[model samples]
Target: MGDDHSAARPLRADARRNRERVLQIAQEALASDGLTISFDEIARRAGFGVGTVYRHFPTKEALFEAVLLGRIERFVADARALATAEDAGRAFFGWFARVVEQAAANQALCDMLDGGSQAGPQVGLRPGSTLADDFGAALGRLLARAQRAGAVRADLTGRDVHDLLRGCLTAERRSLARGGAVRMAEVFCDGMRARTY
Candidate 1:
């Protein structure tokens, strides 16, 4: 079998630019349309040809994965930055509120948490995966710090915080009322607070 030299070569400058453009378009589409947005639409929005989009991201799942990874990285960075704040509890809850609001607005995140994307059942973020682990670890550090500061309940673990956030996101998706996500997060955070007898 002949070796594939193309895989070893870096993308041309134009191709790199095209790939970034496609990713940006795809991210916006995914935020608004979830995974239902088609590659044709993405290409049109990016001012590029369908072939260029396909050449860069071969499949819809591949494109979504790239977009999702970038989003996760952003969230992780935000969490890390907030972890250094003076008020541990406030920092944790603030990050939580921010994430919930963003997630509620982002259809792709809501869809992924609900299960898989519209593309396929297997496109969802699974537990123990690298992306999931990274996100969880960052959130866990905040939770632990808050607990140590007597902000959050001592009984709660990182998994519990994760579940609570997921519930808030799901509720926000189903609720008919506006600002439902903010309300849910507020209530959840209040309930998670440490109790003094």
Candidate 2:
């Protein structure tokens, strides 16, 4: 039984490395070329055979899901890191701006997060998933901290913050190549701040 369990263990080191490499290349391709980027192109860019790509992600949808999930996980981690920042307001606004900038730079990633992909079903993410919960929790903590510090309005909720970020994306689409989203984020942050006068 011990030998059988060992044989059925997780991927070998090389295989794990290959999988990670493939995912990285897939993210780049998706960011630059959108969802239309083929698996063959990803394999080519990664310097791996098409078969290897297939071994890692059996279908195109699976690859898309993996890339989207990885991005969300990273965003959640960033939010968590900001939760302990010395200046709650700066951390909240800075992270908010960074997320908007990332969305502007990578439309594909933004679309995936918004569930605009036809491959949504394949991604298997649902409303109550742990990923969503963790992301929400992190954002909630940041917003609460900012509010308690009197850096942000007490009336705002996490949903309001999300809507504000979505507005940034809309601005980005209208002014592609000009980075309007980042500017919009700055203005939004200013409005969210408490006004003493």
Q: In terms of lDDT, which candidate is strongest?
A: 1
Model 2 lowest lDDT segment of ten? 117-126
lDDT of 2 by residue, 1-197 (tens): 99887875655777999999999999888888987899899999999999999998999988877887888888889999999899999999888888877876677666655555433555633457898677778889999999999999999998787767767766765677764434777777898888878
**TM-score of every prediction relative to native:** 0.85, 0.86
User: How would you encode candidate 1's per-residue C-alpha lDDT over 1-197 as one tens digit per residue?
Assistant: 23466653455766888899999999899877878889999999999989999998888989997887787678889998988789999999999888887887776776565445443665666777787787889999999999999999999988898889888887766662454325677887889999987
Q: State the TM-score for model 2.
A: 0.86
| C-alpha lDDT values of all predictions | 0.81, 0.81
Candidate 1: RMSD to truth: 4.4
Clashing pairs in 2: none
* C-alpha root-mean-square deviation, each candidate: 4.4, 3.0
Best by TM-score: 2
